[model samples]
Target: MFKLCRLKYYLRNKERLIILQPLTSSLDEAFQRYSSSAADKDFLHRSILPTDHFQASLPRLPIPELEDTLKKYLECQRQILTDDEYDQTVDIVNKFKVTEGLDLQKRLIAKDKRNKHTSYIAKPWFDMYLKSRLPIVLNNNPFMYFRDDPRPEYQNQLLRSTNMIVSSLKFMKTLRANILEPDIYHLNPAKSDNMRFRKIMRMIPTPFVFYGAYMFKTLPLDMSQHKNMFNSTRIPRPGKDELVVNKEGRHLLVMRNGNFYVFDVLDASGNILEPGVIMASLHQIMQDQSPPNTEPVAVFTAEDRDVWASYREKLISLGNEETLKLIDSSIFALCFEDNKPTDPNAITRMFLHGEAGRIWFDKSLSLIMSAGGNTCVNFEHSWGDGVAVLRYFNEVFEDSTKKSVVHPSTSVQTDAASVQRLEFKLDQEMKENLQQSVKKFNSTIQSLDVHHLEYYKYTKSYVKKSGMSPDSLMQLAIQLAYYRQCKQTVATYESCSTAAFKHGRTETIRSATAETKRACTLFVDNHPAVSVEELKKAMMACSKKHGSLTRNAAMGKGFDRHLFGLKILAEEEDGRLPEMFTDSNYQKINHIILSTSTVSSPAILIGGFAPVTPNGYGVGYSTEDSRIGFNVTSYPPSTNAPNFIECVTKALDDMYEVLEGRHPAKSI
Candidate 1:
């Protein structure tokens, strides 16, 4: 016992020394100094901002050392490439690490020193997303479906619509006043501020080369002008601070019968419209059904990037200037659907690929509230990831359902006409283009399929009992399933949130690690040579490694985003992309075959997408104490989503049986 104690003591001291050695080494001098700075310490302790006053106080996303990035990149490449390709890629990476990489690093560091952007990676990230040719709906945008509202009164369409508008207006007021607490990493005040949340909240979806926001005033709902509720009498004049302070740009576009009408959600005195008035206005919208004189304009957003760009130019040439401004300046959109969904999955499916005319896939976000009070949000991933939209949904739900938030009337002029309809001037050729877009969009949505699985026999608690990280276990289960089905491990992207740093989005947590591969291989083989105990040990080690990697990513020390920033900087400075970045092996490995993220929420029923790449699966899961639910999506006729989920179900049950020495668990 004494010898064992001494051995443990030696091991503990050795581990401590290993951790401390990095601080003294020249390799990590910048990180050490930054970590020790009193100012940074103080900054971390400061309260989350009510405004952008403390924006500069947050730390910038750090650029990882080039050699380190190359090492990780090469390791990931090995999982996806042939031996010959791997060797060629290794040679390219070696050359890069010694020469061009050094130059790129210098340029990136210099840019970091000179620029004051919220994130060094933001510009390039945004540019790549906007320029991509993929259609928005399932390809690039994410959807979150909320569970059914418990209150029966919310089932009333008019009341539901009115209350939602009120709740949204309240949310905007809190936003403009900067009272909505910025989501800190783990709710830690010292961690990075999620300021990107504010940007997407009031963002407008435009059909131009770029997206922009509008300036407008919120008016009380009018019952007298039912027919004109979809019409506007006044377009608020731009103020001196229209570029920034016109926080009133919270203009919401309402979609009904494949048509759109814009309206400000707040009254002139910054008050929520009375529920009765809002109800009447919604009633008016439901009553009016106008036939199309031309093609639906929003369908153009679903076209290829270049195709849409060209059409947008044509649109501007034949533009109604007022309509263009209305589309540009609106903060966000709200779609009131006439259809009702019976289940959470149904609502999610509707939001992801709703009927074309009633949906606007180009906007930063569109809040779709069904007549039955079922709700979901479709958001553009180019602006941000799921976290930002999740925060918005949380706020709205909390204000509307969780609390009895009240707004008193100030007795301002109540009759001001605020809502307006956008009139488009389309020629015959443009109408033809719209028809083609609709066909393409429909084809894409039809090819997509979803399989919602609820594995109830085992959950997070069972995994915890086995002394394994639930997330790591889930990831391993997915890898095993894919390998069993496809007979190989390809590139996998598990979103590691970097909200711990200011303006950070996500880093790719390379889920296909060596240990995971080994464990998966053993499980698939059910090798008698490999004991269950040995497999458990391997899984636990993999889980620990994954946790460490995720924490590093949260600290802005991940590979993908950092390397992305460096590559962009190199292009700007040298007038060409580095050879290593252009390598075919590099391109092949980065094609994510599995895109997965988990958003564990009681209020959120499911969150997910259609895979970003053609032959991949998009997996969104929620692992609760009692059950594990998976929302899996893929493009069928090329990739089989049902087969993937079948493998997943088997893998999950098999894993549980192996770990717990029990009969296989059941899954649905």
Candidate 2:
């Protein structure tokens, strides 16, 4: 039964191709090397089949029709394959198959762990809801609607990209609570028997569950005090000691008794809290107090703004500590709406309209300078990715404005008439299926480490040989790979990458989503398949292609990766990015390059949105060889298509033609 099921999965969904070449000495070496490489990795090991004794498998369908066919198959099988079956197919092909190399395995494993941790606490109904609703949302492509009005004047107006993100997060939060009704549990790590049993069970199929209770250690308020903490991990830990002083004037520690843990000030309640809940609650608090209003309740005229900058600088130059402190606190006050303006230089007012209203200012420049000015914006958390936080921020702003302030009496009447909901029970089969899905997810993760080191080295070397920037090379390779697999002739395959810009003035916040996250994706066109030699020559030409550098140029640099990772660590420590960049009283620091590389992978890398990463929390991946990698610092997500793989394969078939520099007619 298992073999039959596996066969059906491969025949229906897998992308199989035959490589026919003249028998040569190098051919044997190539096959041996490739086979050995595949054998060492989990994904490739499953998908690859040695046919020394038989003819190679025939190409089942043209490349271009492949993606569409797969999509159709998935859609049609939606009813037949429960989440478990779908997951099983994914596992068998991605993990058990012999095609995914070692690097692919590592990526898959990382994703699997993440997904499992997330699922452990996730409601099955919620996962189902996401599966059902997400496809609808993607198919509708509501985001494309924002692109329709690209006028500069409307850039910051109406529902912008950030606004969409915020709306989505808010909706998800509400849906999770109202519809999913997730059970609250904690991991009790102190009990060795329980912990061991739980770990073992995690390897087996199980329903969505999280560690019921756990307590991890905490960091001190001073960086000097926590030298021992740095020993726990090689990657930089956020300088939590410094961060605590900036936000809450104390050190915060992560307490974990088992899997359940909490990050809080020492001696505080140690209940495990949901990161999503914290984000939603924080957003609600900010939005409710400061509803979206067109009129700037706080503004500065051109002259007053100049004078303020001058005065602040003078005080700082003269080492006037008291005045500097006052200025710093005042800026925070402006950002947080904690104080009223005294001796107002420019007229700043707050305005509120009915739901679906706009926040506008009569003063053109002043309004433009504020958040809703020339650029649309959204906040992000230090720990979270920019995209996710921006989504939450936008949602809060939109939801806050949409709420109509009804009289207390009306509210009471509505509540009194509301009906209590009943809990629906899942049958035994349904429960078993949910458990199996989770197990399959774990199995995929286990396979990721099969060839981690080798795959990483090969990929790194391949990127270098391509002679394109890291982002661009990755994008090109992905495109080529996808083209080979799908064999489609689309007009263009768009690739995009994002850079982060920070202009908001909050030093320390509970989450990274507190600061604004903005980014853009760049697109390029790919030429159709040609012989190997020709394609290589073209690739060389493409790599040499260059244009004047813009801010986008800075983002394309590999340095951005380090900076992005640093930002998260910093935020996690200090509750936000570096304060030096956000000191409104001195000079409002804005814009930092997060991820600069081009979107070069065939697979899409959706980043800028933060992942929910609590200690030990994990996410799952659908494909063994195909996994999404996020550069958290980038503004918008980027994608690389699988066209390059196809190009490489085609090159192998017509090496002599390519060597002669014969160009093929445009087919894709």
Candidate 3:
């Protein structure tokens, strides 16, 4: 590992040292960092299939130099630590650099060489999720809502659910056929997003496809995660969980009033069944008024992972093994709620972690709808992150809302035999276990608070005209809000996709920068000595710093995941933990007090996740043409979500005023 004395060399030379003799066109520091592009499918193109160029089109996720990562880590440490604490951390990090860390870094690079198909962190990342003992409910699962159906008549709960299922199955079918449009982010749509660009790409050989794409200024995101998007379930196992996927499975699973129903969405010929038949099956479940099952077996999914795993074994031993496989192998789950949500907050809660009795949390994607006629996708996060999920989310919403497969007036036929309600023969022990699961679910969901805001003061146009990245502005406001609330800075995590590379997952954009700290202090203190010019400069500085970090994280050069890989290596080695991992400073930086992500799209209304830490805040926001929206969740008393949102609103308005050079936010 390079010492602090070599920092200048690290900066001057940023080219990655690739381990494999493979694709020559792989990008290095010279390429532009990724800007996440929305999901788009082009049907008119006659050339290559959507994912045909996946292998050739993107580079592997890069590993930053050990020196670069350490420098980045130290820079962030200074933002939240005092001089004394920072000094202590520096000493610890330096010691680790020459000793255990050097060996681990070398081993990590060698392992990356041996595994050319994926990033070094891939297996460890999967193990990180699979080995967690926490329940996947509020702690791991997240929900994203679709905009309401524009044609009010289509908003009937049964009709809407039917269309979503139909659209989703269609998406699955198209995807498996490999004809669906690939997930491509066009940097300049005017140049790369049209029919002409398609023609050029069609003539190019598969080996040169990425070069062709580069000519058009488009980047293809990794489609590796898409394989698990359908016909998959997170199966609970002792000590560790596993993702069980059956691509051959074509049936649909629907949960309603604590009952489970299944029907084949695909026929023996591997074709989507008529939408009328699918809608008729859902209609049967929707019309049923059977009292909820007293045991509510599905709630077991919300129990702690190992506890649920044990119960799962009990289920299999009780002659429900076939039944369990059927549930897991289904394409996905569609849940019909007994009651309509009264408001937006209610909707957020319903989808985030619904009546545990009605949700199969293990399914890769669960389509949930309330009796009031609205829906969202609550997904298991272990198999993938936001890239694959959001793609499916956007495509399905657009297809279902604009080109629905079923309507209220469509033919209705009820066949009890068409849908199978899974029956599990449970013993007394299993039934009692069910009750325990429900109680745990209620306790966890009840302890949380959610506050959503749709601020219409400004949107994309305003941010761009002001010459700032919209996401950066949003991050700045969050830091100020936290400072305004607690009067100090803490570790902030904003997720940036590393999907631009092969088998890429996610990287962290540590949003709490020194500039943000200074800006937050200035805004909150409102000291007369701090001129408006100084405050404006600080805000601008924060925006610039945030943008740079975002780009670096997207390019797979962030410090968090690199440090994570090293820490995991240290744990696997036969020795005491490295001091770098043991340092109190390392613990503080990894706490992730403000876990935030942006879920912005025209088709999506909002998305949210529970705080990763009990006392932290889970912030989900979206920036639209008309407004910028936020949905904040926290465990109350430890953190008041409502008060934080109030502070967030003030911070946004204050920043906007500063940008406009208008009535100085309170102190002018």
Candidate 4:
């Protein structure tokens, strides 16, 4: 029996990918050698600059040929639509190509020219993300779990909690100082590459803050008081010591017992609070026996963005000014859960959409830690892509595990204020609104299904040994699995990063390629005449085609984004909906049934997203040298997640057997 592996299995087998080894004895030799070289000094001097200064100078996202886009769009639709529907789509395409689309393309070009500093499609993409009907938390946002600290001394919730907060403040300091290096792709610079990183790192705990992604109005933490750092291990017992205060909103929101609390994380002298102080304050908040909130205002975050936006305006009209500022200006949310999760699925469930009073889903990064010491982040996707969050956690993970630094004793300040609860003034009408939000949240979460699977049969090395891209092979296998189950090719959405472009997020890499369909059909048909070599060749071809599409998307020449820009301009600017967007063919292809994305981290234990559509399955996977893991989710009854997992596992095995020439051509 091929069964899914547990978190313990992953913990046992998970090996860190070490990129660099620390030098022991040659440290001075290396520095002296570098210092003696005049060329090295000159190189260092010229290479140093502000991380994101070049952001405005990067090239704008380009416009692709309209006809070629139409052709590719038709190719994608052909796999999903019926003959009559496809023909109607073809007619619509023909009409669009000769008429409004061409003029729209010209307008897009003009728009790009007018907006050289930003991508032409960036605004529309952001607006579309916010305006989309799907709730961002589970439906769109992707979350990842970092492994527990290896040091048993730091495993306690209070110690680990303070460590996470301190490390996060340190990272924020790095951002404010502009010392973090810009991210690079393909050993070359990308437009708006690091800018997205900055955006996500600073996302306010609010939805649609000022129409664009929110920037943090961060307060600084002064480290002058502590000679080294707060020791998170058992060396120093946790308790209350000194209070923390911030002038510029350097604070975190804590959601507990269906109530919200706001407090500064820095002192009056601008110094970070002692871990003991934070731990003691946390205990006080958790122990408070406040009346349980029948309806929490934060639940409004889980509502649809449009609905939330309108309701938020009503909230503003009610003049709860301080409450609004507390949510909007805070750096991020720190959600403390009362119930300790028993297993990995429970962790995912809690982190994805926690039980009542355990989540504020609107925050870009919701640092969630359960009583059992399990921790994960439920991120807001509208602000930025997953890479930014991945990078942020990488820093925190590294800082959290580093050996504790001993600091000189400092006098504790006892008179500072502790964390305070932010009470909202709600009337019967507002209470009714919040009640409706809670009902909506319950209905939505109840309808969703999540199944996390870890497949350790093979990994990236074996796929590479077969002379194929690991990512490409994984995509092909996904297509084959979907084909086996659905018995027909469906339009698939594979997120390909276009961070190579200015302010780039992602482009749709249509995974249901003609090559993939051909390969899947051949495998499923079980044609006796087909040989192992032929099957391998077809699979390799599919991978190669996917690679090409991925490259095209990376270069900002993808069909979907270009089409999206043209369509948005036609509708929003010209007040005319294009024939292509309204056609049935367009609707069929746009219905993404298999939404997939690949995110890899050396320290991350698991990562995934909720299914975008009821009938679709959202697959977030990470490929390793000896294993591959997937978190598959969908709406149950209508779409079975377990069946899809079974199909994918079977497809992987079949593909491997055929590659090794160990099994004859068999049904997938």
Candidate 5:
């Protein structure tokens, strides 16, 4: 026993030392092995390492020295050859070169190529650097870093800054490995062209992250500026304090996808026209400059609706040049019933109008003051996501209220690009063959009874017999559907279910910051995908494999591996090999099929909410041509829970009958 212990100790120590030695290597040796190889060196010298190569790249430290220092620091920390350190060093070096370095170069040229390629490395270092550096730069050099002088317009400045930030974030995320956050920020410039400073600021990080309370003092459109505050656009060296403050109300609409829609009431143009002046000016422009006899007619009351209708009817009747031109370039009226103002000082009336096409309406509290009723208006602007609609509304409202006549910074007109059209010609023979196949399938489908609901029910009951929860049962149903349709098996599948525990049902993790309360706990289960009979035999096996850890284990495994395993299992014969099953691979799949009961409630709610009453809800399934694809969402009424089993069974029968070239009715 003493001899054995000594031998074990010697082996363990030798393994430890071997791991430690490579991490303590010299910076010069590490760089030589990891950096440019002879082939890469030639490419670098010829076209990549020139001084002008990185003119547009972010300001990075000088190359060889920066690379050398990073390598030494990583070595001192005993993290040499680590993916994170190596990537950071690579990024610094690559930025100095014109062309990005090749991935295989790092593998073939590095001394510890195996370690470098073994794992993801760049994220951690980049995350740390961004968090540390961004705040400092913003605080110290906000003007120089963000400002654009040649483009005196704030909108131009905003556009330039957004592009810069996006480019920087993309580089950081790609070159680093340990990063999680994927968001960036942008500033919104106000509409006023003459106003020296744009009032509103905007920030967007993700496709869904929208937060606006982080920047600025007053709301964007504060229309209260002093005359002398406007500055020349040509000033090369404007002081940070020299920035103008336009008091006209400003509004900023921030979208999830880092775009800003800003509207300010200040006049950037020399002539600042207030609301009344702007309206009169537009009317004049319409009459004097607009095409002949295309004046807008007001439709203020129900009485006027008849007159407007008659005018339209007359235009159609005339069919002459003048009437045709008028019809072609018509301006419809936007009228409202006169009412007492909610607030005397309110400049913009908030209205909600449901236009035939898309349009904008501002719903700011200020609008409530001007219009006594809820501000609703109909205008022509296409409705999009909530973020986009909000942005458009704010822009239109601010533009209408602006005291200046400024030309739009960006052109609203879109340019059409060349389109390539492809056409394929098939002979009469091919057409006849396709038509025959379709006719045969149609006849087969018309015949099959194909009601597979009873089978589906039997499967569900069989799954329940194994003692799974309702959620787990739903997950199993989805898995079965996939298996039936795709004939594929997966090693393990995990479903994340939210479970609300009653007292004594389950233990809870305590919160360090707040008093612990009953909360939804995440449950994950990974069960082997086997036949109904096999599952029954493994009943006791379920208990050992089931628990909270299953959730973490599945997440750690990742989506790609889970999909890959499914692909592999689908290729297996009968998808069952007894010895091949392992506890680790026995995961419940990340899929769910809404049972009939589950669909009924939501379907009822949706039906109730519809403007027009719905006739009924029907559930059905359709298979895809792909080897792995999900069935359609099933509903109720025509094919609700009670009849879902019947519907799916029928669909499957129809599918098989058609595939096998038999009459579906005969199969039934």
Candidate 6:
């Protein structure tokens, strides 16, 4: 959600194509890397109850000290600023520390004290997302692709959709019944992840349950956002939007050719219908003879939030109150795409920001499938961070594939009485509004381009053997890639989850640092004096600093959230911006050039999002056992996605050569 909250993009008229910059990557290599750990998930959930039983005992997110935060903030700013600029920023920070900063810090602490059940950053973070009026299309929503089913028959579009729906509903049932395993990171799986440990945990009360796991070196993440994954929608209001959850609703929403269809996935007793019944209903919908909608109502969700909110009120006033409610409260949405895309890159674009009218972006989870069985989940951002979403994503893929909920052939009933088609009462004015929405959405999507580049020369297995942190190494590669493209250091953002604490969101792992600047200059600026040994030394320093930053962010001791809290408190309580907060360097530090995130998992094939700035690049990368991949995005003419990807591959090659003790260049 913080990815594009305060962003504004400038567009160009160039035609766009989703390009896959092919390197030495293959499906076999992908399989060898991801197939290592499916058993790890099942091992951790031997026996458990109440997925959220540990919530009451989870630790609260801590507030970093004011001076500590200012110091760390300057460390990040120093790399991006000149000496003169750095001195000015330091002076401004000092003044704030003695003045508005102290009061704001006190007020924030008191507020956190008053709200012990949640984190200090929770409310301000929510407010930041809610107050920003950017349309959630490219600005906020992000997509994660699932690896195609291994069996050819299961990849059939109808079969894939039916199986995924059944798997997702099963997941919801497990979660609602408190049987789903809690999200936990175990340091020693052998000791903390077995049935013995789980049995001990179940013996404790809810308030003290986490301590049982903590004793065995286990940590449970806050699961507050998981509930929003079902029966929820983000309602656009005039000033601020609302995230509403209605657990009472029990139906599946289907969007095809811009028409809305609903069917009861649950019985009167609230138990899920059998998989055969779901397959029959989906098959019936696919055979429907209705023509494509001339004016799709889903396009209204793509409009600017205030405009959409205004029209939403107009929609309700037109005697469609019950209709809108039913749509919002459905379990989740499943979208059927009309196009069959052969190029994997095109599939990424289709899933990321597909045809606007065919997408209902307000729904928390929308499972989209093409006619050829390419599928992904396009998720709304405000309700949760990736930790919550990824848990659902990974489990759904595993359950559907491993359990085989439905076979290739299932008997269909002519009348699945629960299926209902949703009809909107649209006037001529609303119909005209739909045409304008299409124009606006088209203009917005045209400016962005996406590319995926995979580097198979080496991956995490080699990095681990070389005694380097894989995440830290990849972050440096990204920094090096940007410097090679731009010839300078700039602000960078790496996502780190703080979900170990109560109601935690995310903390910025400020990736750009002084050591990274020295390393990039040595490698990319072609400095002749830098030896291979010296370059390796510099790389180690960069990785070490990055690892420290990641740890600090995960521990909730990072400066980003602490500084954000102070800024928020100042605005909320004093109603004025501090001089320090108004500094130009402060603004520059938050511009977030090279916004990169590492998305490595067994279930996800690729993940991506739009850049946070008009010219900046959004980089989603994965470092696996034997390969690395980058899904690069940018608004072209201002920036180039294809060229940026080329630089990334070059950076990875150079870094790997350095790791191999090769003299890559005379300069380095």
The digit string of per-residue lDDT tens for model 5 on 1-668 reads: 44335434543465664564454334335544644564321111121112211112211111122234223222322211335644554454344222212322232234223333221211221122222211111111100001112323423212222222222222222212212111111234343221111111111111111112112211121111111111101100111111112222221111111111222212343122232332332222222332211111111101122332333344345443332222122111122222433331121111221111111111111111111222322221111111222222333333222312222343312121111111112245433433443344334223212121213222333333445432232323333333333333222222221111000011111010000000000011223333334333232233223332234222222222222222233234235422112211212111212211121110011100000011121112212111111122222232233243433354334323332334333221
List, residue by residue over 19-72, the lDDT tens digit for candidate 6: 211211243345345435553222212223468878998988999889999999
Give residue 625's lDDT in candidate 2 (0 to 100). Answer: 30
Q: Which stretches of candidate 2 lie over 4 Å from their true place?
A: 1-246, 249-467, 489-533, 544-668
C-alpha RMSD in Å of predicted model 1 compared with the true structure: 13.4
* TM-score, model 4 to reference: 0.80
Against the true structure, what is each candidate's TM-score?
A: 0.79, 0.21, 0.91, 0.80, 0.19, 0.91
- Per-candidate Cα lDDT values, in order, are 0.65, 0.24, 0.82, 0.68, 0.23, 0.83
Q: How close is candidate 3 to the true structure, as a TM-score?
A: 0.91
Query: Residue 569, candidate 2: how far off, in angstroms?
Result: 34
Report model 2's TM-score to 2 decimal places.
0.21
- Badly placed stretches (over 4 Å) of model 3 are 1-47, 415-417, 665-668
Candidate 2 weakest ten by summed lDDT = 512-521
For candidate 5, the lDDT comes to 0.23
280-328: candidate 1 lDDT, tens digit per residue: 4555666667764246777766666667667777787886666756655
TM-score of 6: 0.91
Q: Which 10 consecutive residues of model 4 have the lowest summed lDDT? A: 228-237
Candidate with maximal lDDT: 6
Which candidate model has the greater lDDT, 3 or 6? 6
- Candidate 4 wrongly placed segments (more than 4 Å): 1-49, 186-247, 268-271, 287-292, 309-319, 403-417, 664-668
Query: Which prediction has more favorable TM-score, 1 or 4?
Result: 4
